[model samples]
Target chain A: MVAINIDRFVKRYGALEVVHDISFDIEEGEFLVLVGPSGCGKSTILRMVAGLEEISGGELRMQGVRVNELSPKERQVAMVFQDYALYPHMSVEQNIGFSLELARVPKAEREAQVKRVADILQIGHLLERRPRELSGGQRQRVAIGRAMVRKPQLFLFDEPLSNLDAKLRAEMRGQIKRLHQTLKTTSMYVTHDQLEAMTLADRIICLFDGHIAQMGTPHDLFDRPANVFVAEFIGSPTMNIVPITASKAEGRTVLTLAGGGEVSLPDGTALPSLTNDGNVLAGIRPEHLSDTPTPGATARIEGVIDMLEPLGSDILVTMQVGGATLTARCTDKGQFQAGQNLTLHFDPARLHLFDSKTQMRLG
Target chain B: MRRLNPAAILMLVPTHLLLLVVIALPSIYVFWLSLNESTYGSDLTFVGLDNYVTVLTSSYFWRAALNTLIVVNAVVYIELLIAIGMAALFLGGVRYPKIMFAIVLMPYAISEVVGVLVWKIMLNSGSGVLARTIESLGFGMFNWSVSPPLALSVVTLISIWHHLPFTFLLIYAGMLAIPKSLYEAARIDGATPWQEFWRITLPLTIPAILISLIFRFVFAFRLFSEVWLLTAGGPARLTEVLAVYLYQSGFKYGEFGTASATGWLMVIGSLGVASIYLWAMHRRMLKGND
Candidate 1:
């Protein structure tokens, strides 16, 4: 079932339109993440869904009912804000039970509901404490507990873990994922952090400049990004993109790297029809590059090592290959030194090709 | 405890000297004066609490104290309600915020004495425009000068009008300091506008409200100008407040020792009123730190 179907959604601030005509559907029980850089209108789209922002043009439907004009409460959606947004003067119990109190639930019933949520979030012991008295992680849990007590149709999280320290962020991220697994409520999360998106989202909507860059599952986004932006954005250390010239030779596509290397497209590889000597972009993930040759490896590039950073499990080797600098993640077993000549190999099938002019991926 | 170094003591000397000259010496002098009976060019004979005993036993002193209590309470509470209302309206997104803010604060820009005088003239019984307007509407003369309750009510009104802007500014700043995201969270949590105010805005602004209350309580307890300039404790001295009574005792009757005792009592009373708010604020701060 489509929980939320946003058709041609548009948001405008007077004359300036921030969210263009974008469209998508969130399936029931699916966790959809809107990931992008700052000011990319990811939060705007989430706010529009939460009814905090007015939709300038287009239709928004929740559970097959039009909700463009509905108030946030009428929409029956709960939001966990980036800053937790707990009432500092109220105790944790009161904060969690505020919605119930507003709804005029009986005191015993409200207390039971609040207690249930507190138990679920493991914050029952801290119920008597105020938000100012709670630690950052505890406050975040209280916020989530507050949202949980509502039991709304949809859950909207606006960068909920962005304020937390790294370890707490990861811990809360796992807790949120576990909670989603147990509840299985449809959720939409907005974040600028790609790792959060990759880990938490069942389906990620990559946004760029108010447009949908791509919408797909995490594996699809990682294995086959739809554009140069998604290719560079979805992974750690980012994908290395170098300019290349493409030409057809012997019924196969031949790529001449701008630096000083060559790569031949494998047989039957889907290729964009290009003009003679047309410029193209070749994308390779740092993790995909190996210091030693591996199976299916067809491209070999040589360079002088420029820098090395160790990450306990692996080392990031930045090498100057002609005019282009490429970073490759190698295992820590290798005793690599800067200024040493090194050769790296990659599989041709793992390469991402884009039309340099449009920056859109080509099959 | 660590001893202060010579340089630190040297740096502190100027501040200590200033406090001694400005605060300590005057307080000590007032204490000394309260213990003596004196008139202009008269020998200072120590009375040993006789002035305090007389003031406490006098019906006039008790009447003035009761009047001061009623007037200060009315002014502080009424001003706070109006200030909260104004702050809420401004926070609800006013169109001409700057202009409206300036207008609300115009009373504060005027000198308190001038503001009280303006109110006094505007409400004068026989010829004032507002008084005539009220009388013409068949309210029968609107004579605040003759009736004690009416006179006290007018003083309270004038005090609220003059000092409301300060209270409003503090509460408005407190309201603004509440993060916008909290309101959004409340909205999503099924809070109506009224619920949002009760649960979020009012609760979060308690610190500001308490601070305003403490200041207004202290200032209103020293209420003098509005009463003195308008009624001058007239109509058989029925509208006399502590400050007016003290002024009459010192300047009008030439009883400086009694006036000094009254001054000390006023300080104690103001401090007593302010301590309630101070206690509440301290409790709130301790809870926040918990």
Candidate 2:
């Protein structure tokens, strides 16, 4: 295992910069997932690390040695591409053993290594099958087996599961995670799916618009999103944002709702520090908004039921509040018709405050 | 009435008629002529298997058949090697790929007769450019065009030159169809350039090679223009392919029956070669499938 370090990497195509001044380090044996939306340069960074793409500006080091000028073969890293990139002409056994054969390994040893990797990936029975004859999941396994047989210093997966169906994707994801644990090799994975990033990463590096929004453990991101984009991006169903006006009242700050209501803040509460106006915004998770009413410095909003999405074990309740639509998950299967009036109760501590102008989490 | 279905049989009538007129008519006429003892007129003596038997027994037919095979094999093999070599070189960071490809492909775009004419002027034994240059270099003017074996070899060379670019372009197109990621994967597997070409490029482009082989074989078997313009079946029929032999039998000797028989022989010979090529391809495909 080798520690991979990327120092201020920049990638430009002609005159347009796709990746701008991004830097991160991957510790040996760490599964670091670079998560971002499409065209945010996650794949570009992975390709640069694999030496498939030339780094326009930056230093890349493996185990403390600069390898900016090395070829992909010289870098000692294997990449499993998004499309699996399996050699269509070769059988699964040949595809897996290709790298070893190229390194001039003896035929018998190459076959053994291929069998070993195939067994590791649980694809040994498919060794005789060509890539086109195999299903998408089988092809992906062969692709991964091809990389595993090389036993390189690091492994790079560029959205390897994106092509698979939902059920097979879940199965393969678990398989990949287990393989990483057993191999104990450093790996870099790129994906736009936050769920995959959250599940597979030891630490998630969140990218937005060609810059790293935040880098932390999954819990760190779920608990303390450094900014608003990280908060909205890392969670499913998205964080709900609502505007509120703040004013100092009776020696305590009170937030006024637009629907002719107000909630008083607790004294000395560590909310987002506001400047200029009495205007601000609130971020709340859908799951945190409860149907049951609670007491004390909590805020409650009343609205009309607009829609309901029943997911097993939980029902997503959409409500019209403060001239905007907000979604909240309801655990109690209390029958409620559309257009019925309802109230949502939530803890103020669960409330995330952000500056109205900058859209950054303030406190 | 119900609306008409898009897959109705009526839609095929026009296309079937066109195929019959364009393709079936010529093939049927050729087959009819192959079985007859007839002049250019429609009057035919019903002779069953006579022309086929006579041509099959003739030494002239056998020699022309052997010569046609020789030319096709030589041209296709040499062209395949040269085309693949040039394609590999161009794809492997040869500077100015487009310019080099254009220069190499220039021969294919030129008129065959003009190319043969130019080469004849260059290789003329008496006062040709090559002869004059060799004399200037203190070597006596070499007897090139008048030599039977040399003329055949030179004609074959000219045929290879004319068609090499088409082969290169076909193989190059196939090479481009292979995604770049496969090469990257091979690189990560520690494959050198030559190993990548052998293990990845060559096997993947087998279909392209087969296509090029079929085209070159079919074209080379009837090799008429270059042989006609350059050697005219030359110096004791050394360069006489089946097409030239058929032409002389039909026009010079006024033996239309022999020429028609020779024409049918060339067609059957090409059919045999094509059948072998297709069978080999089919076997290769079946082995891969298994």
Candidate 3:
């Protein structure tokens, strides 16, 4: 096992700087996921760590040794590409044993390692077949098996499950998590899917536009996001952001919502000091909005139902409140028709305030 | 659903009829004439299979067949090697690839007569650029056209050079179509550059190579321009390929029956080679899908 420490990493493609200076520490035997949207340079960061890409400026140390100039093979790392780039001419057995063959391991030992990895992946029967003969899931397993035979200290996965269908992706996700658990090798995974990041990562590194947005455990990211981007990106159905204008009405601060409404703030909840009584963006996740029809300061908005998507265990309901669109997840399956008025409630503590100009979350 | 239009078939009918009149008629007439004994435009007598039998039994017929095979084999193999090597070098980040590729393809774009004439001038015995260069390098000037084997080799080399660009372009396109991720994966698997080329690059290019082979083999077998222009089957008819023999016997010697029989044999041989190649390609494609 080896711990990886990356300090002040930067990458440039000619003139455009893709990965801005970023630093993070990866614990030994941990599955760290880097999550971001397209063009955010998340994959670039992972590729630099894998040594598939050059580090423009950084210190990448593996077990206390600087490995910036090391080639991919010399770095002792294995990568599972997104396309599952198995050698089409080679059979599954040969693909798994390729690295061992290159190392000139004895044929028997190569066979033994291939067999063991194949058994763990439950693909022993597929060894005799070529990549073209296998299904997507089967090919993904062969790709993983190919990596496993190398027995490298670090494993890098570049959206390996992205090509699979939904059910197969879920199954493979579990298998990968199990594999990481059983093998206990330090691994880095990159994905745009928040669910995969939340499920597979021991610590998730959220990135936005080549910068580290936040890095923490799944609970830390979900419960206490450092900024607006993390708050909106980490959850499904997205967080609803409402623009409000703050004003002092008779000494008690009241925030004016669009379409004519004001929510008077309690004495303890002062206006964020960063912005001077100007416009602000308030955020609330869909799950945090409750369906119970009680009245409270946080439950000030009344809305007309726009759409409803029932997900068996939960029903996702979208509603129009004033100028803002709010989504709420209700466990009850009561028929909520379009144009029906409904009262939505939420706790004020779960609400997030951000400066509208800079988009930075305000405490 | 829309019905098929009668006008669409009407538009195709004239071309179909033209094909029958222009192409099908001559093909049938050739088959008919091959079975008859005819000297120029004089007395055409039906001789059944005698013409074929006479051509098949002739000693020169066997020699022409051997020469044809030799020329085709030499040209195809040399062209395949040159094309593959040129493509690899050009695609491997050589300076000014487009300019180099255009220069290599210049021979193929030129008329075959013009191409062969240029090579003839360059390979001429004493005063040619190649011979003079060899002489300057301490090698004596040698007559390439007078020596039968050397003449055949010279024709083969010219054909190789002329046809190389076609194969190179095809294989290069195939190489480009392959995803770069495969090479990345191979590198991560610890494969050396040579091993990557052999294991990944070469095997993936089988489809393109097969296509180039079929095309070059068929054309090389019936090659006439370079051999005719450079050597003219000279110094004892050592380089008299099947196509040249057909032209010589029919046009020069006025032996239409024997020439037609040889032409028929050549067609059958080329078709046989084509079918065998197609069958192999099908099998390989199916095996890949397996």
Candidate 4:
């Protein structure tokens, strides 16, 4: 079932339109994430769905009902804000039960509902404490508890974990994922952090300049990015994009690197034929490059290592190859050093190709 | 007890000296004067608590005290309601906010005596613009100079007009300090506009409200100019407030001892009213810390 159908939605502030005509649908139990850089109108779209922002044009439907004119409460949506907008004056119990109180639920029933949510969030012992008295992680749980108590049709989270320390953010991220698994409520989360998007979202929508850059499942986004932006944005350590010239040589596609190294495309692949010899972008994931060749490895590129960042299990080795700087995640822990000439091999089939001018993926 | 830092004590010397010269010395002199009987150059005769007894037992003093209590309460509470309303209006997004703010604060900018004199002229029974307008509208003349209630009402109105900007500024700042996200959260929680005000705005702005109430109560207790300039406790002193009674005892009848006693009474009365809010604010702060 379609939980939300955002059709040709437009948002304008007077004469300046921020969100252009955009359309998408959220499935009944899907966890969809809107990921983008700051000011990309990701939060605006989320706010429009929550009815905090007005939709200038186009229709918004929830559960097959048009909700463009409906109030946030009427739309049956609950939002966990970025700052955990808990009432500082109210105790945790009151904050969670505030919606019930406003709905005029009986006292005993409201208390029971609040208690149930508190226990689910594991914050029952902290119910009597005010928001100011709770720590950041505890406050976040209370905020989620507040939204969960509503049991609305949709859950909207606006960068809900951005304020926490790294350790707590991961912990809460896992908790949120677990909660979603148990509840299976349709959720839309907005964040500038791609890792959060990649981990928490069942499907991710990458937005750029108020337009949908790409929309696909996490695996599709990670393994087969639709464009150069999605290719660079969806992964940690970011995909290394090096400009190269592609031309046919000996009935095979030969990519000529800037530093005069040549790597040929793998045979028996369904890659589209190159009709012209022009500038193209070759994308390689940091993790895909290895100091030791793999079974499918058919291309080797040499570079002088310039920097090394140790990450306990693996090291990020940044090196200068011709005119481009590429960071490769090298797992041979102590084998690489700065200023040392090294050769990294990658599978030709793992290469992502994009038109240099359009920045669009080629096959 | 922690030992006081000599440097910190040294840094406070100037302020302490100023307070001693301006407030402590004068208060002590007043207390001393209240226990004595003196007239211009006459020798002082110690009459321990006699002046307090005289002022406390007098019917005129009691009437004046009652009048002061009524006027102060009416002025503070009515002005608070209007200030809160104006603060809400400003918060709801007013066009040309800076200009509107200036206009709201204009009353405070005008000198208190000048403001009172302007109200005095405007509220005159026969020739005043407002009086004629009201009479033409079939509300009859104000008769502020004759009727005791009318005189007191005029005083209250002028006092509120002159002092409203202070309370409004405080409450408005407090309301602005409340995070916008809280209201958005409340809205999503299905809160009506009234509920948002009650649950979010009112609770968040309570400290500011309490601070303003404390200031207004203390300031309004010393209400003299509005009543003195407008009616001068006229119609057989029926509109007399505590300050007027104190002024009459000292300047008009040359009873310095009784006047000093009345000054002490005014201090106690102001403190009595202000302490309630002070206590509430303290309790709130403690809870916040908790």
Best by DockQ: 4
User: If scored against the real structure, what TM-score would every candidate get?
Assistant: 0.96, 0.92, 0.94, 0.96
Q: Tell me the interface RMSD of every candidate, in Å.
A: 2.1, 2.2, 1.8, 1.8
lDDT of residue A143 for candidate 4: 94
Best to worst by lDDT, what's the order? 4, 1, 3, 2
Worst 10 residues of 4 chain A by lDDT: A267-276
lDDT of 4 by residue, B226-282 (tens): 888887887888899999999989998899999999999999989988888888888
Model 3, span B1-290: residue lDDT tens: 98769999899999999999998898888888899887776988899988899889977778778888988988888888887887777666788877877898888799888888877887776788887787788877667877878888888888887888888889888888778898999899999888888888888888888888899888887899888898777777777888888888889988888888888899899989888888989998777731
Residue B242 in candidate 1, Cα distance off native in Å: 1.2
Clashing pairs in 3: none
Error (Å) of candidate 3 at residue A150 is 1.1
Please tell me which model should have the higher TM-score, number 1 or number 2.
1
For model 3, what TM-score does chain A reach?
Answer: 0.93
Per-residue lDDT for B114 in model 3? 89
Considering TM-score, where higher is better, how would the candidates rank from best to worst? 4, 1, 3, 2
DockQ (Cα-based) per candidate?
0.67, 0.61, 0.66, 0.69
Give stretches of model 4 more than 4 Å off. A248-254, A259-276, B1-8
Q: Considering summed lDDT, which 10 consecutive residues are worst modelled in model 1 chain A?
A: A268-277
**Cα lDDT for residue A212, model 2?**
92
DockQ, cand. 1? 0.67
Question: How many clashes does each candidate structure show, in the order listed?
Answer: 0, 0, 0, 0
Error of 3 at B244 (Å): 0.9
Ranking by DockQ: 4, 1, 3, 2
Q: Write the per-residue lDDT of candidate 4 for residues A1-363, one digit (tens) a residue.
A: 889999998999999998999999999999999999998899999999999999999999998889999999999999999999999988999999999999999999999999999999999999999898889999999999999999989999999999999999999999999999999999999999999999999999999999999999989899988889999988999999988887766776677888876664566444554424668888999998888988863677888999999999899999888768889998855998899998888887788988887888888
